[model samples]
Target: MRKWLVRRALAVNVRVKILGIALGVAVFLGGATIVFLRGYLVRVWTEDLRVRAVEIARDNASRSTDFLLTNNLYELYALLRGAVDGNPDVRYAFVLGPDGAVLADTFGPAFPADLLSVSTVRVADDAEIALLQSGHSRLHDVAIPIYDGRVGTLRLAVSEDRMRAQIGEVVAHITLMTGLAAGFGIAAAFLLTYALTQPIAGLLHATEAVGREEFAHRVDVQTTDEFGALGESFNTMIERLGVVERQRTELLKRILTVQEEERSRIAHELHDHTGQELTALLYRVSVVAEAPTLEAARGELIELEKAAARALKEVRLLAFEMRPAALRDLGLAAALQHEARAFTQLYGFAVRCHVAGLGEVALDGESETAVYRIVREALMNTAHHAQANNASVLVQARNHTLVAIVEDDGVGYDADAVLAGPPETRFGLLGMTERARLIGASITFESSPGAGTTVYVEIPIGAGAAEGADDADSSPDSG
Candidate 1:
């Protein structure tokens, strides 16, 4: 049941990781596109407002010029005064004479007298007349040179801040609209992805269920789509997988039962027949082989002794390989160190083992078997496959778990490619990963084409580790 959970969690992690990438790309592109379009629209909107303001200015100037020409100063002054409360954009539409004096102003005396005097003083050849300064105020003074058969200048100004306020309201509305559009766009993308990938998610869940020996769980989505067809085919595949799993379980039980029965028979035979024969042979060989007489037979006797010793070593090696002397005698850390040094000596591969906080820590039998075998297999593979000159191993506490990292500066193969190979070919990885999973651990294999390979194992330390330690601590000789 725990193994099943890890598979499901791994599937979800992969999905979320891929989805995160897609979401990131969507946000970046969407925001950039919105900003670009908004900038262009704002430019057009501001220009439109500017043109309309200019038209209003020209109309007011014409009226001021008419009043001045008809000698209606009272009417002209009233129009200028009334224009102040008209809008914040039209600052002040009043007159400025040839002298440096304001003829009339809607705003009080704080306004500059020489605001639009430059235009009235010197005549120019243009439609919309402009002043010299771009102020931060609400006043923009423009002049209209009268062409009504006189040299009179109709000086006028409207509030620049008022025009901006009007334009800003439009921009504010656009900003709100852009925000709403962006929100809608993001929601649509999320929904579209969820709808599109739902079938894939279901397939993943089914795969995880099957991996954990849950035979009842099957894909049954019925549709004409590619995913639906895959689901149907996958259901058939799961059915066949269930049969294989049952057969394998029964076969493993039979094999274990037979192996135990044979070991018992061999133990008896060795104690009775072979043990006595070898003892007598050793005594016979030793008695004559040590005698200095019969030189010709002496060489053959030495060979016999050598053969006997070699046979004994082979038996011992096989017995120990079935388990391990140190693993049975000492704890997991000591056993690991012993194996690491042996590997360096026997295979000429430099291996380092560093232990910390392992004084009283002992691993359960199953976990010890898994971890030790993983390290052993890793070393063996390095000796066979990794064309490395040097390697290192570090085991330490990381965060909430114990982490073991094995790294080699070898010509590393693609980790994904190796993991994806046939089950027979990836038996090493399968053994390590399956064992790790059974005990709530995680194994990560990382490699690059020409860089190196690193295998990391994270085991949670607690009851699970201690459960097997007692059994694993049985001395090899005691057995």
Candidate 2:
């Protein structure tokens, strides 16, 4: 049981899925890492920097220049620098006149006239001012305007060096965290997935081995999970299959034995009862014809001879159909050839027979009879419904299988439709099908409306047994 479970867990379907999921997980983590490092984390830091710059500009705007120019340098500087308590992002804050002269600044650089005029505020407008430094230093600076109903131009500016530093630190932290997370997540994912798939794989392999007739194959996957349940299920299935196979083998023996006994009994009746009765009647008729008292009734005597001849022919046919003596006499190959030839001649359709790989051998009675009946039904259907003028038969032994193929170039019928019909329509086809099934063999029939029909039967033959084989043959009536 453990062995079987392991094999089933090794099934191909599970291996393929494991590989696919592993690849998918790798891609997902890789893409997520790229998004976090390249886009989202950087964006978050940039937004934080902008918010801090705006707050500094708002505080410095109101105190330095309101109503009229109230240049309170200490108050404005304190507001801009936040009292200089360890926060460098509030570096330099100041106000600018319309001509770009520095009014009050926490740091000592004259604000550029062109920058103050063209930033966010106009001559009389009160608005936040934003600008980026291009040359010696980097700053994303914002400024605000302070004014009363009489005053016109009062502006404040705050340097953004501290915001840039903070953003850099945040970006570094995010990169490290994302890298470590993706690395650990992907490794764990692959390992867990592979582990999860083992039992299922074992179960699948066990089933495949059983399919290939390796009845001893077992699966062993020890767990309390669903796959463990599946392992138990598979063990049960194999046990059931073994039991069924034993029952089936015994049943086949009994069924074949019974059939052969029945055939033998019928053959004896035809030879002893029916054949002898017809023979006695033929003798009486011949003796009566010879007597001189019936001289004027000569025509009636000829009719009697013809009727006796017909009866004798029918008795022979019945004996052949029951169990052909050639099956035991000349062996399976010759008997089948004889049957095919006779059918062709009688039905007026050309019959071709191909036999190869049928090494000279002998077979048991049951095997011989079973093969003969299957070929007989196949030929009968070809002759009747095939409407074919050209027919061929092939017999061969390959892959330990005895294959017989009968083909006809007739206006073929729908194979599925005919096979699907009620017993009245599909009787012959179903009988042939059942004959193949009684053994461990299979049957296939192919046809279309305009194409020809082909019936194939294949059976396994053992080393010591005589196997009858045939080929794809055409019996074309085309009428």
Candidate 3:
């Protein structure tokens, strides 16, 4: 159940949540303030009423001294009645004799005999004030001793009903104002939340559209804040993703076309070279079978053996061209060195091989194949197109990375032109790139019109790096 509520809360709109929390906080603070103020105000007003009642009782005691000393009950009662008439808050006013007997009373004939006796309170001090319950109402009771306890005492009860009514009115006004302020605060919070979340909402919708392959969707907000910048960044990212998607589709199409072309080339080589050699060998064998003399048969058998050898060689060469067996048997380093020597012998170019740390570099089969292919393609491009003499293949390991660099002191073409040209013209380079990508490696070409071409292939050595680390450290510095 708690998880359900949490999920429900998370599902609420950001604007609604912001407003609700803000309004709730405001209402809580307002209610607390009103409660505290009401209590403080009530205390102040109640204390004021107590002080006033004491003052009035003291004054009346002084005024009724003569009446009390002369033993005139009627005059004392008139004074008490007049005091009660003047002060509307005074609920009951009376005089108490020195012996604790009621003498003059404002209630006259209706005064209870136990009125003074039932609630009699003696204080050591001359005058003492207190709040007490009287019948059905709460009263502020004040008693003042006449002549410092030599004569009767004056007592007064002030009703707190009026004070309570006033306090209630004040609190009602405060409560109403608090409620109105809370309402206004809620509205303000809503507006503020809307302003803050507008850009975020636009970004959300734009992302959803982009997820649906609508790469052109952009956030519509135009503010100059962080959200605006974020929206702009999001749009730029989507545009880049669209470009990459198109490039990926084009790359795949070109790769398929290249695969088909490679198959056709392989078929043509087998049919033209191997098939012709085998046919010639069969014809020579027929000649040997039809020979009338032993000498002629022997000569024809020798020719037939040569033709068979040629056909076997052609078939082996075709298989090697399809996938080099040297790469699998001799490892990446030895295979590269063999290819370099072969390339030098065939093309009459001075191709040098430099290998470092590869003796301990444990590369997976796929990675070795990829590196070998990249180097072979780079060298082939140099021999066919560079038209210069010196070329070098350097393979080494550095900082957990297997780095292979092929450099040629030959006339270089614009690297960017090859990269941007049609796939047919750049098929070899494209194959190298795709091969490097499959092994999670990167290939970079550095060249210009007059400068020499350099191709660098960097492969990450994730595991078994420590085995190569010592060899790499101990190896001599590379030029």
Winning candidate number (lDDT): 3
- Reference-based lDDT, residue 468, model 1: 26
* Backbone clash count, each prediction separately: 10, 43, 0
Query: Positional deviation of 447 in candidate 2, in angstroms?
Result: 46
* Pairs with backbone N, CA or C atoms under 3 Å apart (clashes), candidate 3: none
Which of the two, 1 or 3, has more TM-score?
3
Query: What's each prediction's TM-score?
Result: 0.42, 0.40, 0.80
Compared with the true structure, all predictions reach lDDT values of 0.66, 0.66, 0.82
lDDT of 3 by residue, 1-479 (tens): 99999999999999888987997798789989988998999899987888788788888899889988899889988888888899888988898999988888888578866546445444436567666776677887788999886888898889988888888999999999988888888888888898799888898898899889888777785877888889888889988888656556677888788689999998888889888988898899889889999999999998998999998888877777767777767677667777777787788787888877774346888888888889998999999999968888888876778898999988998999988776567767777888888899999988999798999899888555535332212111122
Native-to-model Cα distance after best TM-score fit, residue 23 in candidate 2, in Å: 6.5
lDDT per residue (tens digit) for residues 1-479 in model 2 = 99898787676465465656666776676667656665664467666766665655554455445423565556655565563344565445555555556655554565545655555623223445455664655555565555542333333333445545665676667656756665666567667776777776777789799989777788886887877887888888898887657555655565577589878977787678667767766766766767667663565567666767766676777777667777767667777778777887789887777666665553456656777887787778878887888887787777677788888899899999986664456656666766778787789999999899898888888764334443333333332
Q: Is candidate 2 or candidate 3 better by TM-score?
A: 3
Model 1 per-residue lDDT tens digits across residues 341-392: 7777777767777655443354568877777788787777787888876666
* Top-TM-score candidate index: 3
Cα TM-score of candidate 3: 0.80
Candidate 1 lands at a TM-score of 0.42
Question: By how many angstroms RMSD does model 3 differ from the true structure?
Answer: 5.0
Q: Which 10-residue window in model 2 sums to the lowest lDDT? A: 470-479
